[model samples]
Target: MLALRDGQLYVLAPDGWTRLGGPAPASSTPLNREDAEDWCEREGWDLHLLDQVPQLTA
Candidate 1:
């Protein structure tokens, strides 16, 4: 599922954080980055850039 608060978007899953589909809302919908981050943090999750991960090749 998806959730919006302040101006950010969040993907809810049974496990840890899912993914960020878009930036904070600006027009029709409502989203909050800070709130989302806070929620994730509260849930022991972190928002990180995939690029930060080491590249893998097979």
Candidate 2:
């Protein structure tokens, strides 16, 4: 899922945070939804915005 938090964007998975962008050099620079779409599409995936990201359990 795509989550915008603290003025930055992150990509998350069931395990935890993962790199964004597809098959490209991973970037720390945040990506907005539109750019995210292009990235995911390149990998044959779709970007979906989540209303909330569940807190990670420590």
Candidate 3:
């Protein structure tokens, strides 16, 4: 689960990774894993092609 540093709220998941959100670093790099189709559908994320990578852009 992901939590705000000030403890305002959080995201809970039975099985998934959580990130501390912020502007990504200056370096050009990928983040997060490529989830399965079923997993994306279950999570309400729309996977699309972004810069040749399958991106969960929801």
Candidate 4:
């Protein structure tokens, strides 16, 4: 699954979310990994991703 955490794009993986690069409508480079499970208890991963969907352009 795809998501955004702190303005960067992320893709879900076996271990955690890996940064796919962006703040979108911007640039892309240097992907990284951030442990996103912490968010599962807070606002929920689905909510987080939903909030950012409008920020993306087709």
Candidate 5:
């Protein structure tokens, strides 16, 4: 699963929570699911397919 905390993105990996990259823009706009998936793909991080993970709230 993925989460945005403190303007940064993180992905839950087997080893533990791993940071994906730099901080996100401090704008009102939020990252969508599709974009996050694409990012994980480019970063070579496996995206989990679980629905129990809670959504990230602003």
Candidate 6:
């Protein structure tokens, strides 16, 4: 999962959440993983893995 908080973008890594880079522009919009990737690509921002968390088995 990914999140944008306080103008910065973070991704959920194996260890924990990690910041992708510097703060996003004020005009940036909230987006899901796929959309975020596309947005980053079009905007020339670095791409980060957008892996979905695996489901836990009981």
* 48: Cα error in model 3, Å: 1.7
- lDDT tens digits, residues 23-48, model 6? 65577566777787886578665565
Residue by residue across 1-58, what tens digits does model 3's lDDT show? 2323243323334433344356434563433444444445676745332112322444
Model 5: per-residue lDDT, tens digit, 1-58? 5566656676567675666786654553555778767766887766563222334566
Per-prediction tally of clashes: 9, 0, 0, 0, 0, 0
Worst 10 residues of 6 by lDDT: 49-58
Q: By lDDT, is 1 or 4 better? A: 4
Query: What TM-score would candidate 3 get against the native?
Result: 0.24
* Tens digits of per-residue lDDT for model 2, 1-58: 4555553445666555554544333555666767767776776553442334444445
**lDDT (CA) for every model shown?**
0.48, 0.53, 0.38, 0.49, 0.60, 0.61
Worst 10 residues of 1 by lDDT: 49-58
* 1-58 per-residue lDDT for model 1 (tens digits): 2554334455555653354766644554443667656665776655552112222234
Better of 1 and 3 by lDDT: 1
Best by TM-score: 5
TM-score of each: 0.34, 0.38, 0.24, 0.35, 0.40, 0.36
lDDT for 49 in candidate 6 is 40
Model 1, which residues run further than 4 Å from truth? 1-10, 14-31, 49-58
